[model samples]
Target: MALMRMAVAAVVLLDLGIRSTDLEAHYTNLGVLPLHVLFERAWNPYEFSIHNMSGLWQVQALLFLAAAGFAVGLLLGWRTRLMTVLSWVMLVSLQNRNPMIAQGGDDLLRMLLFWGIFLPWGRVWSKDAEGQPAPASYTHFSAATVAYVVQIALVYVCTAFLKNAPEWTTEGTAIYYALSLDQVLMPGGRLLYPHFELMRWLTHLTYYTELLLPVLLFIPVGTAFFRTVFVVVLFSFHIGISLTLFVGLFFVINFASLMGLLPAPVLNWLERKLGPATQRCAGYLGGLRQRLPAWQLPLQVQATWRPRARKPGYALLPMLRETVLYVLVGYTIWWNLDGIIAPKYTMSEPLRWFGYQFRTDQHWGMFAPAVFKDDGWYIIEGNAANGRLYDLYRNGRPVSYEKPYSVMALHKNDRWRKYSENYLFVDNSWMRPYYCNYMLRLWHLNPRNPPLKRLDVVYMKEVSLPNYQVSEPKREVLCSCEY
Candidate 1:
């Protein structure tokens, strides 16, 4: 659990750093998603975002800073429970601010942090321990424990069941279609692209792995052996995915989620193999903890923030907490099951609102059902004041209809790529002009560059077809912003 906390916190800190790059563009009123438009179009009443309390980027920056601080606290296991809840809240709030930028990985990360709140993370390798010796054994079980393990299993099972499309089975070409997407192609994926036969076989392997491997987690005996096997297999599986796809942090987050379930055996082996080094590091960390007296004041200020273990007779808090957790777990299962069993089902208002309120609603759509066929790239066109047209994406160079050599690198990161994917839908047309104007404003920041008269957010669409057939690239102007 300590390892899981560190991994989740590291991912959160890294995510904040990457997102801060586009603070204004992605999260401010001055950029793409102004709060008024968001509340009007994409908002959910139950969805809460403290980041939206202010329109200025400065406020968002302050929030980002606070979130980073909490992630650091979680990483170091300082006030573990408090840090975990704060990290989860900050994560959900930031995600709610712009759901367009979110993906499966973001959901996984958020869910892990939410469950982390109930798990013990300050036991070892944590400042909260303050030189407390390691537990003689690393085995435990609780409501949170059961929920965490099953949560990981549900991710795979739900996704596998949702993939009812024939392409994943009879066609066995889901991987081919997925890699054919130039917009998200990775360097390693290019090498394997020619081996369609291998890709075909791998597709079936992936399906069964997701569908069956998670069952081992529930085996009644040899828990260590089965858990080890599951971790090694899926860990390698996602590693292969990372090398062959441009999924931003999805693979990494999966790796972290898997770490929490690693059986006692593997961890014990690691400790034995690195005993000397581990002891030295532990001593150093213990000394560091002793030196840090300042960390305790704020921790005391927020003393009421942490949950106290109830007295033997006090049943109300325990009962209420347990009831809510069980309801959340049951609701989560029902939500996923409804999708698989009744393909066209929506949760009734109360349940749906509950999901939104707690941010427990989730679906692991990692290319589920069918591979996306809209394989394309964006072309940001700028028309300058002196009858000059430039390709702003190429740094104000002459305009061209041709695609770049590396289309995958076009997006700043997976967030933008996911946002761009959302931008492709006609229902999201309202977002285009904001993006266009945002780009225009950015381009004019350089005084050497002439002001643009207008800007065009264009997408060159290419639809992927069966048997390696490719459609001609179509020039589609998604949004035209007049300056």
Candidate 2:
């Protein structure tokens, strides 16, 4: 089973290599604009800014080479650990350099690489282990397996549970907006927009599948069936997003996750096909040991003769405990669904006062203009009547201030303005109005913002307000500027 999986992984790697040139072209082009921005900010570094790359293009090129090398190593199963590590590093660096360009697959790929590292992925099918005795059993349940399964489940569970929001369920319109969004991002977006109905159905299916996936995990027969279904659904999902959003990274990640669903027989077959060279390598190592000096020979023998620990019995008690724990954890996750799906919209009154709008405004002209300033430190000032300033920091250290302006005026800020000038400001007012309305129309979505209760306002005025009045102020005094 392990060998078959390795073979499958190799095949997948080959496919990726074949597509590398085209993918690299897209990656390189997407990164160029950010690289230029980073170069411009060569003096000061910002957390999502590219200010630190001394030789930005060179770094990107090196990363591409590293990714290619890792892929080759993966295919050959040579230095599998090192290769997996390098691949992860390359992919993560690329992602961190410009997260905006990354899609869902990029996130999944990075995680899957970590999972691959945890498994003895190279034990049976690797060139490095050629001719070594293959393990008697291949289906040992390790922490890596548990972690990988848990992580994958989390993605689906969270995504599904989160869709409980009015936007996803009520109108079922999330699909329409998502599909329509491509028209503005891609060159020929208009052509894709007409397929709104298809996109809508896709969206519905996605939400439904994600929501029910956790149940499928526990079902005996359903596990394999659901895994297959998920792969197909995710692949189609990635294809849709790629075509519409022009994001290919998500597609790769979804493809990689398919490894989890592979059968044991397939992996074993691969090992048999590739085990010869591995055996030869082991023989060579044995020969080298024989050539070792007398002084070191005893130590080597001692190292090889270390007593193996007895394996623990898989008793019913532990199984029951694990089952109970899994159920409890699942329930906990289900309870926290709101936080995962609509983090911005689901806050308490006090938190909402902090200008944490759950759903970010998508339309133009919703923002106010403001001049942001720092005195060897940071403070943001907003231009609109309801605007408020902010102090930004990370890890208790001050970084930069974030001045909240209407989405329309976000570009007016010198720092952000440049990003909008070249790249389409998909979040700006120009795009938001159509998207929000279109989504609302299709989904029959209701705003998540809670209505201001009369009693709640009275309490707020006394506790949180600057002054109180009988008739509540028509214009809201936006949140405070304190951290």
Candidate 3:
């Protein structure tokens, strides 16, 4: 639990820091959607957000900074419950502020944090734990624990089932297409793209692993061995992906979730290694306890003196807790089932109403059924006050100068990279506003430097396997902004 909390806190901090760089553009009233409409149209009724209270960029920035501080508090296990709740609220708020930039990884992180709010993850290896008695090593179980394991398993199992395409099964070309795509690929992909046979074998292995690994997790025999293998293989796979693709926090978030499943034996080994350090830390806290007023210390420190005595009321409390867990479990199960089951079981309106309320509404499709074949990049054009046509993208050059694999370099970060990919799809209506936003951004950057005119969505279609031949670039005017 401690490891999971630390990993989650780290990822949240990184995500917030990344978004902080573009606060005005991504998080405030000045942003493309603005804060007011985002609250009414994008935010779920159940979500708690300071962003909804104000549209001012400064207010958003302050909230972002506060969220970052909360993440740090979560990492250190200080005021764990409060920190967890604040982190979840900020995550949901920030994502809703700019839904266009969110991807599957963001959804997964949000759900994990929501579940985390109900878990005793900060009981050990945290500042909260530090102030406890002589030793902090402890263990307990809750319904939330069971739900967490199931949630991670469901992610992999559903993804495996959804990958029922010829590209993944017969041809083993999914990885080939994935690595070849200019949008997400890193330099490592360029080096890996030439090895067709190797990539094909890897594709098959990837599918089989995702399909079978979750099953092994449930096997009672040699549970330790199974978890060790799962942790090793999945961590390696995510690391390889990170090296080959700019997937934002996807790998880190998923990898951190796996820490929750680390076998007790492994955790025991870790505990043994850190035992001495913990003892010294605990002793220091013990000394502090001697000097300070008992009430002045944090609650965790105070708890040692007045540990709750078991009472008859505890029996009723457990029943109440389990009842709430049952409701959450049912909702979560139905949530996943509706997305994948045939004929699609629809939850009642009252239940479906909770979709955004808890921010657990999810779609688990991750490169499923089929890998994309048509991969490309965008080329924005501008007509300057000098009456010259500039690429707007390629340092004021003609569109021909646009590099084939420049998408990785062009985007500010992984969020924009995924946004670009989504913008190219025919179904994404948000592209118009995004394009308009881009023109406005350009105007702000320089009032007359190649004054903005129009933007184009040009796709430099990539070559697929067996044929491995590039096609001519295709261009379409997606949106235009005057003045």
Best candidate according to lDDT = 1
| lDDT (Cα, tens digit) per residue for candidate 2, span 237-322 | 66665555433334455555666655554444545665556556657787643322221101112222223655567466557755
TM-score of 1: 0.92
User: CA lDDT, every prediction?
Assistant: 0.85, 0.42, 0.75
Stretches off by above 4 angstroms in model 1 are 131-137, 279-311, 315-320, 343-346
TM-score head-to-head 1 vs 2, winner: 1
lDDT of 3 at 337: 72
lDDT digits (tens) for residues 11-33 of candidate 1: 99999999999899889999889
Root-mean-square deviation of every model: 4.8, 18.2, 4.6
Per-residue accuracy of model 3 over 1-483 as CA lDDT, tens digit each? 778999999999999888888777666666656766565545566656667677788888889888999999999889999999989988887787677788888888998898899888876667776645522323446788867877887788778888889988889989888886777888888889899899999999989988888877878799778878888889998998898888888999999888887876787677678656755766788765443321121222223334568898778987888788868877887887774676647676677767767688877778888877667666666665666666655665766735564577878888877767766667665556655665557555874465555444445554444446666655566667665
Using all chains and alpha carbons, the TM-scores for the candidates as numbered come to: 0.92, 0.49, 0.87
Residue-level lDDT for 1 in candidate 3: 71
RMSD of 3: 4.6
lDDT of 1: 0.85
Ranking under lDDT, best-scoring first? 1, 3, 2
Instruction: Quote the RMSD, in angstroms, for model 1.
Output: 4.8
C-alpha lDDT (0 to 100) for residue 58 of candidate 1 = 93
